[model samples]
Structure formats: C-alpha cells, structure tokens
Target: MDSQAISVEILKWMLEVQCKEALVPALLYEKKVRSQYGKAENVQPVKGVLSKRALQVNAPGRDIYGLEKSTEVRYFECPNCERQVAGHRFAAHIARCSGRGRR
Candidate 1:
C-alpha cells in the first residue's frame, strides 16, 4: 500500500527472518535517511487501547527547608557588605552600588 505500510511489512518480515545482525545497520541507515528526509510511520498499536498517563498523582511539593510555604522574606548574606539583606532586593542593591562605584 503506502510507504509506511510497506516499511512495517518489511520490518515484520525482517524479524520473522531472524535477521538481528542486519537489523541494527538497517535501523541506523533508516534514522540517517529520516534525519535528512522524513520517514513514514510503520507500526500502529491495537485500536481502542488508551496509552498510560506519564504524570503521577500525589507528587511531593518543592519545599526544601519547609519554608517555601511561609510568607516571610528569606535573607542572604551580602558579598560586598557582609550584611544580611533580603534575597529579592540583594541583586538590585548590588547593581546600584556597583554602578555608583563606577562613576
């Protein structure tokens, strides 16, 4: 029929022939040709069968220190001043200071 159907038939015949050693080289060549010019879909699973979902239910939250849920601002030690400053404002303040230093 179509190229896809033909490819699938060829694959099935190859498997039935027990051509394992030839399969790898054939697959590699197929991949190379597909990479340059797209190939056709060959195999199709049985109809009316739904594929399994990839995502998991009841996944853990990303709270490393159990503080991610907290509303309190996290503080970080400033490299230039060695003082504790709010994490959010630290970078902006550092940029301002550096810009002032350059003037």
Candidate 2:
C-alpha cells in the first residue's frame, strides 16, 4: 500500500483501540472514520432482495406531503427579471419579481 493508504489504515487501528479502551465512543469512531475515509475499497456493495417485513413496513406510496411524484421539472422565464423559475415556484417568483423595479 502507498503511504496515504497506510496512514489511513493506521488511523483506523488507533481509533478502534481508543474505542475498545473506552477513551472514545464507538459511534464517534465510526462517524469519524466514515466521514474521513469513506467506504473501504475492498468491500463490495451487496445487492439483494429486501425482506418481507421490510417490504410491508416500507411499502412505497405517495409521500407524506400528499403530492404525487412528477418526474418532469418545468421552468418558466420571468418577464420582469428574465430569470428561469421552477414551475411550482413560478407564481411566487412572478409576484416578487413584478413587485420590484425592472433593471
């Protein structure tokens, strides 16, 4: 391994030792290592089917906001400031833009 990889592995070992000795919280060590080194290159992401319990509990449906999912995003150009605003927020944008003096 190169110097940088070696250093990261050494740091990980030190963090684990500190965690085992109760000098640092296990959660903190996990968070620090994750935030700094990210995922290990040797580990492969597992792809599998979800459990029946997970499927039942996490059944996909309309979001809590009750708005149906629309994949397409539409943009409208503001006549006053000539800024492109998202379709959902266009009304509010127009109100604010129209209230101000045109450049």
Give per-model CA RMSD.
16.3, 13.3
What is the per-residue lDDT of model 1 for residues 1-103, given as tens digits with 9 covering 90 to 100?
Answer: 9999999999999887787677878999999999998867787876886444311222244244433355679998877778888988988778766676465
Q: Residue 73 CA error for candidate 1 (Å)? A: 1.1
* Clash count list over all predictions: 0, 0
Candidate 2 stretches with Cα past 4 Å from truth are 1-68, 100-103
Provide the global lDDT of candidate 2 against the true structure. 0.78
Q: Per-residue lDDT of 3-71 in model 2, one digit per residue for the tens?
A: 999999999999998778885576688889999999657855457966555555555663445445568
Model 2 lowest lDDT segment of ten: 59-68
Top candidate, metric lDDT: 2
Model 1 earns a TM-score of 0.31
**Candidate 1 wrongly placed segments (more than 4 Å):** 1-69, 100-103
What local lDDT score does residue 85 receive in model 2, on the 0 to 100 scale?
A: 92
